[model samples]
Target: VVVVVVIVVIVVVVGVVVVIVVVLGSNGGNVVVVVVVVVIEVVLVIVVVILLQVVL
Candidate 1:
């Protein structure tokens, strides 16, 4: 149980960090694309957590 929680936390933290870095590092060209990317990342994180819960 502890290990599962730790893995989930790590995954979430890493996903958030990646999103932040990408958003901050990108040049200003398409705001819509940025928003879409952020939304996709968030959805991916949620899916990962849900899958983890189901597996554990």
Candidate 2:
């Protein structure tokens, strides 16, 4: 379970980084989009963590 959580977090982080890079490259860095992506990523991670805790 821990390993899975770690992997999920890593994947999420990598995905967010890639998305931010792509967005910046294409749109010349839109702060609103970046912020929204980050917020969503954070919420996803938090929800995953909470679910894991509840399951365990």
Candidate 3:
């Protein structure tokens, strides 16, 4: 049950970040900024998953 909740949260966060990236990309935002944001988000998701695994 905890694992399912964590997965759902991660999916939602990734989906939102992807949507933001698409919108910013369309608006001519910097490619470097987009890449950095994506990288940070991915790292966050991985960290959260790992922590949850240890806890549960």
Candidate 4:
């Protein structure tokens, strides 16, 4: 049950991040900025999953 809630929150946050990143990209975000943002988001997702694995 706790895991389900955590997964839901992660999914929501990821969706929001994707929308914001896409909007920024459309609004003249440089390639480097986009790449950095993507990499950081990937890292964040990995970290969260790893933490969840440990916790659960």
Error of 4 at 53 (Å): 0.1
lDDT of 4 by residue, 1-56 (tens): 47755875776587568767676667655555557766776776787778778878
Candidate 3 Cα errors over 4 Å, as ranges: 1-29
Relative to the true structure, how large is the alpha-carbon lDDT of every model?
0.70, 0.78, 0.70, 0.69
Error of 2 at 51 (Å): 0.3
Which 10-residue span in candidate 3 carries the lowest summed lDDT?
24-33
Candidate 4 lowest-lDDT run of ten: 25-34
What is candidate 3's lDDT per residue for 1-56, written digit by digit as tens?
Answer: 56766776877677677767676666556565667766776776787778778878
Clashing pairs in 3: none
| Per-candidate TM-score against the hidden true structure | 0.51, 0.58, 0.53, 0.53
Please provide, for model 1 over 1-56, each residue's C-alpha lDDT reduced to its tens digit, 9 standing for 90 to 100: 56756776676677667667777877675455657766876776687778778887
| Clashes (N, CA, C under 3 Å) per candidate | 0, 0, 0, 0
Model 4, position 10, has a per-residue lDDT of 79
TM-score of 4: 0.53
User: Which should have the higher lDDT, number 1 or number 2?
Assistant: 2
Tell me which of candidates 3 and 4 scores higher on lDDT: 3
Ordered by lDDT, highest first, the candidates read 2, 3, 1, 4
Error of 1 at 34 (Å): 0.2
